[model samples]
Target: MSYVITQTCCNDASCVAVCPVNCIHPSPDEPEFATAEMLHIDPKTCIDCGACADACPVEAILPDDKLDPSQMRFAEINAAWYEDHPAPEGWKPLVPTPAPPRDRGTLRVAIVGAGPAACYAAQELLERSEVEVEMFDRLPTPFGLVRAGVAPDHPGTKAVTESFEWSFRREEFALHLATEVGRDITHAELLEHHHAVIYATGASSDRRLGVAGEDLPGSHAATEFVAWYNGHPDYADRTFDLSGERAVIVGNGNVALDVARILTMDVDELARTDIADHALTALRKSNIREVVLLGRRGPAQAAYSNPEFLALGDLTGVDVVVDDADLELDPVSARAVEEDAATALRVRLASEYAGRPVRPGHRRIVFRYLAAPSELLGDDHVTGVR
Candidate 1:
């Protein structure tokens, strides 16, 4: 039997690199990847070799026979993707990258920030016969976003860090943690010690929406909220005002959905994961019963990935609220939805949620489309949103 990709797929595409038959659709190089909800495996071409399953960080792939009742539907989902995408037309000859000249001799490299890119770069460099690597990070911890940015409940996604262990174990590799580069070491010093320096420091700040009251005390960026909940040292002391019954997030992207989920999730379930004590305590005391995500575009143009949108519906005691009005797209968008499988799936999923009854007494996440925040309401703290 072939392997099927399930709802938990994180879209990290770790499995794509390991698939021997190249059955995974929307590999990072493909145009579909940017809009793809989740990567799909082509069952017709799958060898059932289990290599993709082994490499999948979130354990999203399972053989058809091994799938439980809840996941059995994914078998058809996998097959359906191939109906539209089909098998890759033909195999291309493998082109090997040329090795550095022998005279280059015992290559030494310095990598700044121990994030996924740095670790992966170290791995690739260490694979060369004479290469040696030294990795440095300002923070004491490693795996930048994997440790501090990923939602704690999604531990399976964090397991991708295991692949980086080899870089630490290599005799030619060195790691320097809790050492700031500008203060502890200079760019000239890095150049003096290594052949090249690669900076992998991930984005640390959030993009502002530039509304008038955005600078008010109650308003906060999605990145800050994520870091606060994930226990990043920089934000462990941070706090949020949870006394309000309804919270409004300005965007419809993954982070906005994540913020909504974290706000509405059962505190007990959150406790089982590694959420920060401070944030969890606040959640337990939260009076927030509704989280409204505002999007400037229609449902077809919503920014969330399909897997995340699907997971939101599965949360216990939470209702994904969608208005029927948002699902009706204009003629141009309607045509795009019909032609693009990814966009069509997003609209179909939103329509399903729109048709579902909002259970009484369940906490709600309302999807508000074709709406943008003109200004945050209130003089001191947020009292309402316009």
Candidate 2:
């Protein structure tokens, strides 16, 4: 009977402003709004006005009858939030007051990097009639990570980029290709032509393991591994030493999951997506059968999202294992993990793994936590990591 906010929500919180009953918790005024993984609609107090659904620009809100098959889990997820915490009676939805029109002066903006942040900023600016936007990037293509950072198998996530493309095509937007700032042009020069220059250059650098032998031939950062497999032009010609039967990743973040998934996924399944050709050919030649995802904290402290870990289990020909020793939750993290729907999913995945050696010929993803990497042992090349 209640509307559910699904995966497409994106934490934008557009729906909360329009709801009259103010049933949504952690509204932009709440302290948790910034860090909450996604916005949730309180089922207990929802009046079913459908105002929130109408306000969501991404069409992420779903009423009971129209719930998409893949998104049905969200209904249970939304309801679960109020299991222990009861909603107060007579609470009214907070309806947002429309803002006065902005007096956008005749200012020209040039944004560098056409990634998610850049595109979102452009969309916001384009609402005004007096602003003109020009987006620039080094690559000939657009939508940086949407094309390269996302997993080849995640067609739905990649599809989100279409809205950005539509904006550029339909609006009076200008895009300059093969033009990189600081290389082809300098920041000062661009400022001369435009009133404001915004740099949406995302974190391009990867954190190093900082252990000895990190620079060895076989050892690689997850960023490089992801970019290579996704067919990024800069990494298209790069190669990895997947000759070993086992590989170890140093972190347990979403990017680490991406690396493990790409390495373990069947080449045929990847080919069905828009994966880069050169990287696909190299993945087909990989001999790796196991990947150890190392984390410095317990499972409750792990940084990966629940949906990501759950999706890992569904990949073809891959087995995900979680060590029981790492799943123990400290008091604080335990409470937080239990409250989060995504973390709850990860906790369930950890419980499903019993003590057993992973079968051979099948790709294995091992979740190792609360242990620090003392060293990366190797000689001329990475023989075997400790």
Candidate 3:
């Protein structure tokens, strides 16, 4: 069976860059790519090598025969997209050129953070001879976001680390784990050893929710929760109180969905993944049954990608809920969706989700729109959200 791009495709364009035959549509270079609902694979031109599937961050691609009943429509959708949009003439596959030789003496570069951005830089640097790249991360592990930010269940997306690791295989590249820039070594000191320093220290902190009672014991930033589950050393010992029956997440982005999914997923299924042991133990005992995702704007204004929003419907035991009222778009948002393809896809999926029948499930995720929390309810701890 030919491979197809499903609803969970995050539109990250990682797949398009890797396709050898250039069968994927709405590639970053195309005019319509900005508004595309989800990427489509031309089944006729697809080699069925599964390269796109491996590149997908959310595990959204699947073989035609392997697609779930609901996802079977995507196969047709993928094929139909090609009918009007033929492959461009003279399109060639991308191949990396070998780095030219450097006649100069050894040049040293210091890269801060061992994340994807930093590793990509190292890769380019190591392509040339007489160049040495030293990568530094505060944590002991490399591939910062791949190891800590990505959800445990989406291992396919995490597979990009394999390519990052190839940079380490070069003799001129060295990784310094558990090394702090300010405390262990100063920028001035780095300049003394290396010609230049590149800081890729990934966003280390979360933007404040800035609501009253946010300082309550139960009120925690999404980053704290993500870091705890991913087993970041600084957050490894942290604990979450899942004593409440309903949990409220203040944002509607992909990270919010990831946190909500982890909370409602089957503990047994999570056990099979690489979630932190402490988080797994706490989750097994959690009483949280309802997760409310609060978005300040209408569905058309959602910051989440279509694939991430659509994936909520496919969770095994979670009933995804969206109020019809929340989906009713204003004139401005409707016009915006008309002009922007990404927003159009998000609004389309949200509308579809709102009309679906509620299924019997152990947990529920309620998406609330146009509702902003002015304050977190509680005296000593966050008991409710306003």
Give the per-residue lDDT digits (tens) of candidate 2, residues 277-310: 8878878999889889888977766788655665
lDDT tens digits, residues 1-386, model 3?
68999865656677887888888888877887887767889888888899988877667789998988868767876786776677775456655577655676889999999988898899888877889999998887888887888888777667667766668998899999989999899999999999999999878877887889989999899989998998888899898899989999998888999999999988999999999899999999999999999988888887676667777787888888888888777899989877765566678778787888877656998899888899998888888888
lDDT of 1 by residue, 74-172 (tens): 787778778778878654433456877778689899999998878889988887778999999999899898888888888877877888887899999
Q: How does each model score on lDDT?
A: 0.87, 0.77, 0.84
Query: For every candidate structure, what is the RMSD over all alpha carbons to the true structure, in angstroms?
Result: 1.9, 3.5, 3.3
Sort every candidate by TM-score, greatest first. 1, 3, 2
Error of 2 at 230 (Å): 1.1
TM-score of each: 0.94, 0.85, 0.87
Instruction: Please give the ranking of all candidate structures by lDDT, highest first, separated by commas.
Output: 1, 3, 2
Model 1 accuracy (lDDT, Cα): 0.87
List runs of model 2 lying over 4 Å from the truth. 1-9, 14-27, 44-73, 84-104, 331-346, 354-361
Each candidate structure's count of clashing pairs: 0, 5, 1
Please list the residue runs of candidate 3 whose C-alpha ends up more than 4 Å from where it truly belongs after superposition: 6-21, 25-40, 43-63, 68-87, 92-101, 339-341, 359-361
The local lDDT score (0 to 100) that residue 329 gets in candidate 3 is 79
